[model samples]
Target: MAALRPCTLLLPVAALLFFCAAGFAVRFPDPPGAWLLSLAAVAAIAAPPLAALLRLFGPARWLAALALLSAFAFAVESLGVATGWPYGRFYYGEGLGPLLGGLVPYLLPVSYVPLVVGAVAAARHPRSRPLWTLRSAALLTLIDGVLDPGAALLGFWVWPGGGPYYGVPASNYLGWLLSGAVSSAVLVLLWPRGSPAPPALLDGTLLALAFWTGVAAFGGLALPAALGVALLAAFLARRAGIRGCARVTFLKKN
Candidate 1:
């Protein structure tokens, strides 16, 4: 384990998510089990960035990304509490048996890891054509629209007070938009070299969510929307004079 420590540094998040998903499946039925296990997943996904950010402690970009992600998380959560819109239709039941603030449990937002990772992966995938770019953005915007409450039915995650808002309310799709835009934007700003492999953390989370929350809950709605956003992003980048913004996969050597 000690020898593997250094190797683990690059993808600490994926490792965490792998275990977490397993843990969630273990207890399988209890909400408390799901909540704690979900927190572990959050840690898993967050570990990589958190490690990098810690190394760059004083760098403006590091702090900025953290603040930006945190802000998006805060906004998505706060809005869910206030408007009962976004995420999905499920609601929290009295805040983790009173140990929590009776507000949303903090661990829940950790699930954003895989979603954010998905955005990052989409940005670099060879098949990430512009058509899906902009479309993805729109669909992601509405992903939480149905996902939040939909997941709740499977006992995946939930919001408080349990609304039936606009016939489709939860804190899900809102996070997708944030994850799609903000994560991509941050990666662009960071301009990392080489294409990144999709993180295992993302895969684990998706699998877990599928088991407990059921991935088909939202249909293909979010997928096309995300594609659309990405396409729009590609076009807008070209307009702003960013070279190859229209290109999803460059022909040049990596």
Candidate 2:
């Protein structure tokens, strides 16, 4: 608990920095230390949910989950880059950090896994794994709905054949749907039965949504911004409902 205190405190701060940096980048030229700030921010925001995973599932289980998901993300992304079947023909830019095997970002797992964990945590279904998986996949796809446009605008990646949504193709979202399903499935398969997803676990998804929301708004992409706002509202409302239920149960018991 003592060790986790700093991480818990750092999550929101890191998220705020990323949001500001992303918004600034879209609004103006890249600032000094932007890449470094981004790297640090990503690391910070990713730490808490990962810690939660380890705490909830144990190190072995969490590590296995991380490895499997990372490998899958890299393979799928590499395939997407090479063949353009799932995500459309897109190539990464220099902004997202070093490439893995010169094909995908090394930080891919670091950025991706936590989002999966957070989605599972946020999904409405608790007893039904199938419904949970579907809902989590949808959440992830919705996240990409906001994220892809802003990321493309920021030059994190490029789509040579741009589509209508801020240079992002519809196929990209279709790819996210497939990826999200597989990713959520991996999580549900490994997840401990009857284990509740703690509210703190939602930190990563919230951070991503908030950061992308600001980025999209700053970039003048109205739809993505609105989607981000809606997602945030839904998550917050769900969280409130859960807390309310918990309070009622506690009072009833008392």
Per-model tally of clashing residue pairs: 36, 0
Tens digits of per-residue lDDT, candidate 2, 89-181, equal: 999887777888887888788889888988888884767899999999989999999999998888888999999888899999899999999
Total clashes for model 2: 0
> On a 0 to 100 scale, what is the lDDT of residue 142 in model 1?
44
Task: Estimate every model's Cα lDDT from 0 to 1.
Answer: 0.43, 0.80
Over 19-90, each residue of candidate 1 has an lDDT whose tens digit, in order, gives 344344433545555555445545644554344333333366656766666566656555655565554444
Q: Which of the numbered candidates is closest to the native, going by highest TM-score?
A: 2
Give the 10-residue window scoring lowest on summed lDDT in candidate 1. Answer: 242-251
Model number with the top lDDT: 2
Give the CA lDDT, 0 to 100, for residue 4 in model 1.
33
